[model samples]
Target chain A: MRVLGIDPGLTRCGLGVVEGMVGRPLTLIDVNVVRTSAQLPVAQRLVTIEKGIDAWLDEHQPDAVAVERVFARSDVSTVMGTAQASGIALVCAARRGLPVALHTPSEVKAAVSGNGRADKAQVGAMVARILRLDAPPKPADAADALALAITHIWRGGAQARIDAALAAAGRRTS
Target chain B: MRVLGIDPGLTRCGLGVVEGMVGRPLTLIDVNVVRTSAQLPVAQRLVTIEKGIDAWLDEHQPDAVAVERVFARSDVSTVMGTAQASGIALVCAARRGLPVALHTPSEVKAAVSGNGRADKAQVGAMVARILRLDAPPKPADAADALALAITHIWRGGAQARIDAALAAAGRRTS
Candidate 1:
């Protein structure tokens, strides 16, 4: 399966695409950032983000998307922006009829670096090592996105089985 | 100045544009929704949002944009999507060099209804009264967006003064 991972931000969103199957090594397809500015109006900024995501999707055509789940905290403004960005990603995935998987930051880190508390540098290094890249991914967020995709793929098998069991159980009860 | 307000959401984002000076009654230019479906892919949904925002901007040419600040307390996946959508709005505005303003939900409620704890209907009714509209804006989110813009215009005067003070201080120090 091809997975597109996104790290959403107001000014810059990091995206990574990888192709692989369960229990197999993944191939990195592309990674980049969608950037906006503080000076621009909110509507225009939204447009830029939308356009960037659209272009990426058209170019990569990943089978599935993995996004980092946002945890709420203080800084209401930041949380709002992050949530909006995440909504855009989900909407984009839904628009294309593609399945989406969300992973927590700790889960992604643990999957990539064998530690949930692994820093960005550690995670990047580990992603490069796992993907067997000649160099680390450019931006740290991109690497994190790649790690998120890999983590989803790794965990997807068990989750699918559970989902199947749940569906079957529902059918029997109904 | 013309200000665009956005109530960002997963399926439908409410948008409103108003034009006026600070402390003066504002003119409503437009109000509408940018919608996406669950069946579409995440990337394509972003594109739809971008196009919607761009079309609004092209038609209205608002000088500034205001968006309701998000606060996510539950649903990690949903929060992430909301953040991404908000980021798209920020990016769209920034690209156009229009200033972006953020308002908390309470701030907007207080501005429109004089009660921070006001419900949606109360706020919407107050907005219609304040703007002298024939009726309250349709869709609670749309009304909220309008209130957000109005609040920004009202609160932004103080922000301008603060900015001017800082500028003067810098000049004196220099």
Candidate 2:
């Protein structure tokens, strides 16, 4: 299954695509950020983000999508922006009829670094090690996106099967 | 300034654009949803979303964008979809260099209905009453989007001043 992971943000939304089979190694297809200028108004910034994401989605179509859940309590504005960013990712995936999964930062960190409380550097190192990349993914955000994808790949098998079952049942009921 | 509020979703992303000056009543320019079917791949869904948003932005040219924050905890899949939807909305604003703001559901409810715990119907009624509309905005989601935009308009003036100050300081330092 191919999975697209996203770390959503208003200024810099990170995206990573990975492909894997149930019992095989995962391959990294792409990683990048959809960035916006802080100087711009919020509406214009959103336009840039929409276009960039559209281009990326067109270029690398994945079977499923995964995104980090934002749960910050400190800054309401930041949390709100993160939530909006997350919504955009969901809309993009759902429009395509691709199934989506959400993982918390801790869940991704645990799956990647074997510790939920692992720091960014640790998670980054582990992701690079697992992907056998010559260098760590740049801009912490990109690494986080990759880790999210990896986590989904590790746990997505059973979920996919369950979804398939549910879909079949729904079809029968309909 | 005009603020566009979006309630992002996979199947139906609600959009409401409201124009207002600092001390004047807000005007609702438009409200609608860009809907897509579940039969398509994720990539096609994203394309549909991009086209819808791009067209909206081009027509409205909003100064800022506001979106509803998702806080559901029930289904992981649903949350993931909502997050992605939010991401798309943010990207739409960011691409156009517009400043984006987000408001939690509770915050928007409070702003519109004078109670954070108000239900959708109550909030919708209040929005219609405040905007002096002959009918409540349809699709519940559309009303929520309008409420979010109003909240941003109410709060954005001071926030913009603060952002401007920060930008000036950063420019001097750089």
Per TM-score, the best of the predicted structures is 1
Q: Reference contacts recovered by each candidate, as fractions? A: 0.72, 0.47
TM-scores for chain A over all candidates: 0.87, 0.86
Tens digits of lDDT, candidate 1, A35-70: 889796555656676678778889999888898877
DockQ of 2: 0.27
List candidate 2 segments past 4 Å from native: A72-77, A158-174, B1-174
Say what the RMSD of model 2 is.
Answer: 8.0
Model 1 agreement with the true structure over B1-174: per-residue lDDT tens digits: 788998876678889887777777788778888888979655566668767887888999988889776656646656655556666677677777778877888898987788999998898899899788999998887888788778877778767889999999999999
List, residue by residue over A1-174, the lDDT tens digit for candidate 2: 778889988889889888886567788899998888889655565566556666777898788789887764425556656666666676667666778777998899998898999999999899898888888898888999899999999877756788999999999999
Task: Give per-candidate clash totals.
Answer: 50, 54
Each prediction's RMSD to truth? 5.8, 8.0
In candidate 2, how many Å is residue B64 off? 10
Stretches > 4 Å off in candidate 1? A1-4, A9-65, A71-129, A133-143, A149-174, B35-46, B73-78, B157-174
